[model samples]
Target chain A: QGGVAIAECAACHGEDGIGKDVEIPNLAGQHEVYLYRQLQHFKSGKRSHKEMRFESRQLSDADMQALAHYYSQLPR
Target chain B: QGGVAIAECAACHGEDGIGKDVEIPNLAGQHEVYLYRQLQHFKSGKRSHKEMRFESRQLSDADMQALAHYYSQLPR
Candidate 1:
């Protein structure tokens, strides 16, 4: 579910979840709890990234978890 | 430079900066630039964690980089 939607995030975040730099942030190995919180933040506009907010707004709660799990398991 | 001081962080953060859980954050693969900014935030009391603020306040700029580098190279 998340894989299909999250495919677009990989271009900048990397297929393995190692993000580019300070501008982004490495998501690999991060706590699933934290990732979920951030996703919620994004969706609710608390995080306020123009792109990420828009993207997260489109995701269902289950999709957020799948994306969180995928990134959490990726190698940092 | 940072090794002698940061030894305290390893107990929970892991020798590799793979933090334990939602309570602690992983540092591996994180941006060096972001790490520096966070350290600065801790020092200035902006981040507001009792432990991190005290810890970062005691560090010199050079020590911050050394710690940042050490964590940056560790695997996620």
Candidate 2:
């Protein structure tokens, strides 16, 4: 992910994208396109969750793409 | 899973739990606990996506459990 730090994601999604909480999704090995799209939705307000929207809104397209690539590559 | 009529779910999430849109997550074979928790979150406003919130709010706890079980059993 181009060396960007995404520590915030680890709080809920865990360090490996296997989400820490049962309510959260395990992002590991999910489709990269799907990851990117969901981030876009959260950023655009098409999808709205308090924490996710806040986090995603701060992401640039590059950040979103990088995170998507990062998570999609992880083992579930 | 017990013939509770969840036709509304088939719109974004297809008949087989494979989401029709690239942005949506495929729910097939996802964790039952995870699915159930998310449905609860959507139902309770802990998470919010317009359509999801609207639909989930209409579901009873039994409906959430049934839907979760149904999706978790499908092939991803």
Candidate 3:
């Protein structure tokens, strides 16, 4: 469902779930609940950052959950 | 040299450079130069991401460089 969004995210984040670097932070193997919460934060302005807000603004609740699912399953 | 700064980072990113999850992105084994540039972007607002902006805003140029160096050396 969110494979498309994952693809876009992969452009910068990488196909394997690794981010660009330490500055970017890794998303693989994270808790699904945490991931969902962060995406929600980005979407609702609770997190309130410029880049994330733009990225988060584009996602639907379902999309965010899918992303959370995909990442949570990865190996830490 | 960057161990202290790295300590703060380890709170979220693992001591090994793996991030919290797939959404956060890993920093291990990334290009040093690329890492440096992104830190600069975060500090200068060129990247303009929210959570990153706040995080970057608190770092000194030296701190950023140190962080870049530490992550680039980790295994990807």
lDDT of model 2 at position A29 = 67
**lDDT (10s digit) by residue, model 3, range A21-68:** 544546666567767987897788765568778988899999999988
Ranking by lDDT: 2, 1, 3
**Each prediction's whole-model lDDT (CA):** 0.78, 0.79, 0.75
lDDT accuracy of residue B10 in candidate 3:
74
Question: Could you give the C-alpha RMSD of every candidate to the true structure, in order shown?
Answer: 3.3, 3.7, 5.2
Relative to the real complex, the DockQ score for model 1 comes to 0.37
Write one digit per residue (lDDT tens) for candidate 1, span B1-76.
Answer: 8877678777667777878767577887578877887787788865556888888888999988888888877766
Give the poorly placed runs of model 2, Cα more than 4 Å off. Answer: A2-21, A29-34, A37-60, A72-76, B1-4
Cα lDDT tens digits, model 3, B1-76, are 5667788777667788777764555566666776788777767876556777787777888889899888878876
lDDT of 2 by residue, B1-76 (tens): 4354467797788768877876677787677898998888788876676888898888888889998989878865
- Looking only at chain B, model 3 earns a TM-score of 0.84
Candidate with top lDDT is 2
Candidate 1 ranges with C-alpha deviation above 4 Å: A41-60, B45-50
- Which candidate would rank higher by lDDT, 1 or 2? 2
lDDT of 3: 0.75
- Which residue pairs show collisions in model 1? none
Q: Give the Cα error of residue A46 in candidate 2, in Å.
A: 8.9
